[model samples]
Target: MSNFSNVSRRRFVKLAAASSGAVLLKGCLGNPPDTTATTAATVGSAALPAANVGTGETPEVTTIKLGFIPIVESAPLVIAKEKGFFDRYGMTGVEVSKQANWASARDNVVIGSAGGGIDGGQWQMPMPHLITEGIITNGNKVPMYVLAQLNTQGNGIAISGMNRQKGMGLKINDPEYVKGFERNQGRKFKAAHTFPNVNQDFWIRYWFASSGVDPDSDIDLLAVPPAETVQGMRTGTMDAFSTGDPWPYRIVADDIGFMSILTHQMWKFHPEEYLALRADWVDQNPKATKALLKAVMEAQQWCDDPANRQELVQICSGRNYFNVPSEVLTAPYEGKYALGDGKPEVNDFKAGPLYWKDDIGSVSYPYKSHDLWFLTETMRWNFHNGAIQDFDMARNLIDRVNREDLWLEAAKEAGFAAADIPTSTSRGIETFFDGVTFDPENPEAYLASLKIKRA
Candidate 1:
């Protein structure tokens, strides 16, 4: 039996009321609890009452162990917990734990259901496909499902002070520019990324290849933790790194590096991280899964609201969360990016990293075409060579048993109209900064067209 116990409805309501009074008292005393300090005990209860279900409604399984990392992209998960959305959906016993790294987050979920660790949390876009292909789990395929996309367009690549002094600018696509630096420095450029086969790696490789530089030959790529990327740059051990905010923003704030390019510039409206869950847990507790999705979707909407941007930054910068200065978090949320080279601020929609436009498009939907792109890149780099070749096989690995239905169902429950749900699973053709277009139906052709690929 699980050690966690669900709070009864009556007790939950009582706790919420008492907590409200405590919040008011704290505000009056001018010593409010940090937003990141919100836990099950501090949150008191869900913000709203549980929904009423008709006769045949599946009862919600209230206990859950959700895991997360310390990054701004994980804001939706943090908001869902801090604002009582999980409790409102009948999840009264939710524990949101912080993992040390992406690998730790993935491993916790893989062993969670059986080892009392984590049942679900935020994960990379390609993680489910990698796990299903048996690449990362040591030949054990864990059935994972991505219910919703967490955020997008918030990541950037930064060049260290040394590179900046060498006259390296933001445009990395110029072969002559890169060659000049290499010739002047007399050594291959060293770059760092948080992971091996994810967005950061793909973006850096694509940029290098487009610039007529062989990523494998001209640059020495290293894997550094997200928190350590800035330090690595300061110590002159790394020339540049591709990572998500607010680390990139923090590096600029500290005057150690300059922002070269935002990932959104690489591919507009590109998919980033996701809110993933165990397939078995989702199947066994359909109501609970739906509840979790509803809460997270609502949080996503809230985060995208421009009026709440500052408050969101405050919550994310608390000691229990990213633990960074609020200014670093504010830059990306408000679409104000510092170029780190003594340039004026650049304000553009593409820089809105966690964007969710009202009515027109949403950044939270889990499109299968996005998954296919990640899979194709994974294969292009030979991360899982010969494991996923066919389009149908790749689709099965990502959408095992068609779990996107839950996202559609949950979107409806969250008051989204039929128009809000995309008509097709594929987002159609996506064009990159190098004028390369990716069509989901022709992934192999896309792979064949790439000039630099491991496969």
Candidate 2:
């Protein structure tokens, strides 16, 4: 949290309220209706008519049994309900389920029956895509699609409190970052990330690569779940870890670790995770899927509202969920962060909803370059074969997997800027990495051109 900028002016008043011992909550967090004044521009109801949605006429998926793990990344799901987004979109009989873990959630979706217990649920951003490619699971790779990208960025590379006091602290991207480790070289820093090939792993790898350190060789990656990361640090099992939402911030505050590198800075607007469903769910229950999408999108819109941030924190701390004081979750959501080395500053947190969309139908779906970069990484790590057997069809298969067009159509129905939404989204096109630009469309050529590669 050392360097922070570009925070909106609205952040100031919220910070003031927080300091007075008032825990803020947006939408349901006691935030005035006026707080929404700033958010009015973005909230859009769907073009579909939820108005006529009666249990009889509404699509059968009306009972959306959504599954979720109890962690901070699940905000959009919770916000969708609390903020009344689902209601606005005509998705009335929706339920937020508690999942055992990522595997169980995925299994339920794959099983598709009573075991499934639901139509669609939240998933890791890249997971749905990877699963369909036969990377994370072994099955027919059902037609799953993302309705939206939930939260953009909210994590950091953190050290145990023991290490926080080792030096004044570490500033990422600065020459002195790896220097403080001279004495602790042999002492391995146990780092935790959620799952393999997901954003957590991707961002952590990006951070290590940006710092000229090979993540695989330089760090110990423990397959620890997000909920357990805090205790792992408190004890001695994990020395350092990269996780999203409440985990890192909760640990840092308990003196378990000092914030080291922000994942947000390493890759601003890096896709964090998403709320996804089986494509059939969308097709079979078009009305339900759209309603759920609208609700989740509204929740995101609500989360972005600074005025209601404190309230969002309290809900995140519910007994069944994060279960921490509102302060811990509340502060970071508003961009407040500390290095835990006796220094403090405002953090620029990234939050967006590009994760859930139906872009593949539109030209926007096949950001071929974006797919190329992911494919390149998959190949480098032995995840996917380097070749798309049928270059065009593989490209088409990859393109068919996303649903950006659904997002635009829904937005348009809800009275939004339709043309403004592009036909394609390219992770490679933006070239947002630290001082480096990457074009995913031609990943193979880019890989060949790179001066750096595994020996």
The number of the candidate with the highest lDDT is 1
- Give Cα distance to truth, residue 47, candidate 2, Å: 20
Off by over 4 Å in 2: 1-60, 165-188, 342-344, 347-375, 384-394, 418-420, 449-455
Candidate-wise lDDT, in order: 0.70, 0.56
Full-model lDDT, candidate 1: 0.70
lDDT string, candidate 1, 177-261, tens digits: 5655568777668888887777778888887776677777777888888657778789876788888888877788788888777
Model 2 RMSD to the real structure?
Answer: 10.5
Q: How large an RMSD does model 1 have? A: 10.0
